[model samples]
Target: MTIKYPAGGMVSKDVQPVDDDSVELTLRDHPLIRRYGRLAYLVIHGEPVPAGRPRFTRQGHAFDPKRSRDYKKLVSEAAALQYHSELLHGIPLKVDVKVYRHVQSSISKVERAKRLSGKHRPIVKPDASNYLKLIEDALTGIVWEDDNLITDVSCSKYYSDDPRIEVTVTETGAKRPNNLKEPHY
Candidate 1:
């Protein structure tokens, strides 16, 4: 039987009878799997939107503002396109995200050139952590089982004419080493 991938294309599944009462279905080689192996790299084109502070009503109910919700939706949709059928579960993951914002139009040509050339990066708010937070929340359940499974995270921001967010998730085999010395105090 053929199963369709959400993004596009079709993958053929082989069915084998395990017993008289049951059968096992196995997926053949998928394009995404062959190309990226176990790692998932996604790029969302457009301006990066940082997660905003939660808004509270008079009754003390907290809610996300429209902009934050919209950005999260955008991220979720983008992630869905590259999602694999099996979810990454019970394994430590490492996530790397790079957020690129367009350079200010009011800036001088030289400044814009510098920004585009990476000589000057975006050091202004909202902070890089805010962008990372939004991405992590949006990718929950889509890319992996949960964001908490991510043991290593790296985030960066840059200025560019073409604004976009790039995310890379990979399974980290073996636990990271702890090199911290005992406290003397």
Candidate 2:
């Protein structure tokens, strides 16, 4: 806490000595005491925390505190501004969820492999735990208004337009001329 004085007002140059047994002064009566002494005394013993601070503009500018006439509103606005920086980085936002089918290893096939190998050959196989995976993406068009942040989550695969050259075709690929034999009855 800092102490300030009027432009022309004179303040004591020397500090006063306290009694040997004096306890350190605390602000139990006045949580904050940087205001006029008359009002401060009225609130020192039984006053609620005063509501007096400057409002912040939407563009992040704070108006001169001395010019603010509504002390309570000023204080409230300042409180909102004080925490704005932290909020933007960790805002708890709702993201649009997109779910689609992905080729997962058939669980039955994995079980058969494991049983045949007596759990020693390869119990944990690639594509063994084939199941639906949910892809979550954050939509940046909205601002988060909640207090908690979404740091940890479950995920699968995300859809994007990036091009890639896969060497081998998947099992569901379209039938080709050489592989077009009909199933025998």
Candidate 3:
């Protein structure tokens, strides 16, 4: 006989979307704790490198002090940004991470307007998933004791004059917050 996995573990399986049934945590103002800026990156051979693989010199030894410092600072900020008294455990967590990044300055005025109007979507590097990974790792202990307590996650990227990440985390089976209108995120 085959055993069935639990249904609530996946966002795709969510019966009712976060709607009016979860707490909303917004962290756009806090710089270090809010979003990972696209401009902050590790450079090698004059090109910024993505996290995952280690960079090396001619001798094949790797060292990236700036990158290490950036990561640690981000994690520390994550811990500091969390709501101190909130009990974020036991229940399944549904998070919505909307990443706001700065648009390149080289684009023409018309193009910039289009971007600002949301008529044209910016397709660039520094993938959204990478930012989400950093957030998950950084918020592990402070947010919920462990990252495994998270049951659902929603992540997106957008262009903004002020770059930031708007994070909303909610626990299932909890009383809904009073001032919710739309379920859409």
Indicate whether candidate 1 or candidate 2 has the larger lDDT.
1
lDDT of 2 by residue, 1-185 (tens): 22122232122323343344534443222223224211111000001122134478999997534422332232223233222212222323222222122222555766545544445232232221121110111111111233233332222222112111111101122335685797799
Give the worst 10-residue stretch by lDDT in candidate 3.
38-47
Off by over 4 Å in 3: 1-65, 68-72, 78-82, 173-185
lDDT: the better of candidates 2 and 3: 3
What TM-score, computed on C-alpha atoms, does each candidate reach? 0.76, 0.14, 0.55
Which stretches of candidate 2 lie above 4 Å from their native place? 1-98, 102-138, 143-149, 157-185
Cα lDDT tens digits, model 1, 42-148, are 87777888999999999999988888888787788777865545677787888999999988999999999999999998888899999999999999988888889
Error of 3 at 159 (Å): 0.6
lDDT ranking from best candidate downward? 1, 3, 2
Question: What's model 2's TM-score?
Answer: 0.14
1 or 3: which has the higher lDDT? Answer: 1
For model 1, what is the error of residue 65's alpha carbon versus the real structure, in angstroms, after optimal superposition?
Answer: 0.8
